[model samples]
Target: MAEMEAALLEIIKNHAVGLTGPLTRETPVSDLGIDSFAVVEIIYEVEEKLHVEVPFNANENPFGEMKSVGDLIDALQKLAKPA
Candidate 1:
């Protein structure tokens, strides 16, 4: 989970802006000013880098449930874990 979180933070740092403070699991993506396009880019990058398919629908409300970094991490962990 730590590794995943670190990777996520790195990706967010590369794509988003106006981050006020150090990012935490509780930190909201909206607080980091991540836009819709950046979120998609982040998802793509995460999928490619982590070598895991995110079971997400792009047409739907992708960020509807993911409010914080921890939420995303949890989702990724679940999807990436071996069945």
Candidate 2:
């Protein structure tokens, strides 16, 4: 879990254009300055880097209700889990 979390953070950090400091779990999503397009790219990176499929509809917002980076990480971990 820690490894996945770290990888996720690294992926996000790469796309966080607005971030001026170190990325962490507590960092707010708004602080990352990621737009909708970046979110899609991030998901794609997650799938490629982590080798996990994130089942989500393209019509829906992937980062639904996600506030902080922790929330994003938790959501991804849950969605990536095998049923």
Candidate 3:
């Protein structure tokens, strides 16, 4: 749990989200106040960090309307593969 939390935080921090402030799994990306461009940018970063290729398709929403850091991590964990 702690590891996943840390990984998620690290991904966000490595990107522009750090300009806002520190955040936890409960922190909503929407609440963080990032725009769509930033969201995609962060997703790219996450994909690299997780070592998984993110699919860009209309039917596939990687984040899946997630509302929390944990939720995002869980979704990413599913996409992140076993590596």
Candidate 4:
């Protein structure tokens, strides 16, 4: 979980936004004020960085559809965990 959180922070970090506090599961993506395009770029960056493919496009999300950092944690978990 910590690793996934860190990975998410790394992605968001590329956009020049601070994490508010630490990267926690409850942190909202919208609070960072990252626009849609930046969100997609971040997601794709996560995909490339962690080498895990994300099914949905982050740009499709607005109003924090992914909800919280925990959602991203779930994403990474699904991608990296064995089936």
lDDT for position 32 in model 2: 96
Q: What is the TM-score (0 to 1) of candidate 4?
A: 0.60
User: Which candidate should be chosen as best, given lDDT against the real structure?
Assistant: 2
Q: Candidate 2: global Cα-lDDT?
A: 0.89
The global C-alpha lDDT for each of the candidates, from Candidate 1 onward, is 0.75, 0.89, 0.64, 0.64
* TM-score-better candidate, 1 vs 2: 2
lDDT of 4 by residue, 1-83 (tens): 67767877666756737555665567786666676677667766777777776666346453254777667557555655322
Report the alpha-carbon TM-score of model 3 versus the true structure: 0.64
Off by over 4 Å in 1: 81-83
Write down the TM-score for model 2. 0.91
Q: What's the distance in Å from true for residue 55, model 2?
A: 0.8
lDDT of 3 by residue, 1-83 (tens): 56755866787656544356567777766666666566577667766676666555535665658886667667666655433
The TM-scores, one per candidate, come to: 0.76, 0.91, 0.64, 0.60
Say which prediction, candidate 3 or candidate 4, comes out ahead on lDDT. Answer: 3
Which residue pairs show backbone clashes in model 1? none
Clashing pairs in 2: none
**Candidate 2, poorest ten consecutive residues by summed lDDT:** 74-83
lDDT of each residue in 1-83, candidate 2, tens digit only: 99999999999999999999999999999999889788889988999888898988868776778999999999889889543
The model with the greater lDDT, 1 or 4, is: 1
Consecutive 10-residue window with the lowest summed lDDT within model 1: 74-83
| Top TM-score hit | 2
Clashes of 2: 0
Q: How many steric clashes between backbone atoms does each model show?
A: 0, 0, 1, 0
